[model samples]
Target: MENKEIILNILHEIKNGNIPVHTDYNLNLDMWADLIEYMHDRTYIADVTIYWFGDDDTYNDERVHSVNLTKVRLTTFGERFLTEEMN
Candidate 1:
């Protein structure tokens, strides 16, 4: 699949804060990380990270940023991505 398609899919998950386990996706899949890096730079994703702040943990920070948003409520990037608008 092309980068744009993959990016849109990933964005869908990010907004919901419902990231599944790595098993849900191909760990060895090609261009997955590339998609992330590309989104990291090209998109204006809110730094809105989700954390697992339960009482039984004090080690790792399960943090992630927002990327996919169907409603396009925040900024121009989400709007552009959702609408696929051109300049």
Candidate 2:
């Protein structure tokens, strides 16, 4: 899915009180981290913690790595964005 769509899904899931939303999409860990950061950066979400599992030195390599999102919730702006999107 596109970034926008994925973000919307994330917001909606959070709005519905679904913590730590999961996606079945085959996106890489970096992509997920980027998306989470994107939402947080834009103030759409707050109190988010992203856990990165892997050594920093091998971050760019093909080694197995993972990212987990926690404490994520939709901010007021996120709610407004979702409402506007539905219009």
Per residue, candidate 1 scores C-alpha lDDT tens digits across 1-87 of 554655565565655555523234553322343445455567645443222333246746433333233332224676467556323
- Model 1 residue 51 lDDT score: 25
How high is the CA lDDT of each candidate model?
0.46, 0.74
Error of 2 at 48 (Å): 0.9
Please identify model 1 stretches exceeding 4 Å from their true place.
20-30, 44-76, 85-87
> What TM-score does structure 1 among the candidates reach?
0.44
* Candidate 1, poorest ten consecutive residues by summed lDDT: 65-74
Measured on C-alpha atoms, candidate 2 has an lDDT of: 0.74
Tell me how far candidate 1 lies from the true structure as C-alpha RMSD in angstroms.
Answer: 7.7
Candidate of highest lDDT: 2
> What TM-score against the true fold does each predicted structure earn?
0.44, 0.73
lDDT of 1: 0.46
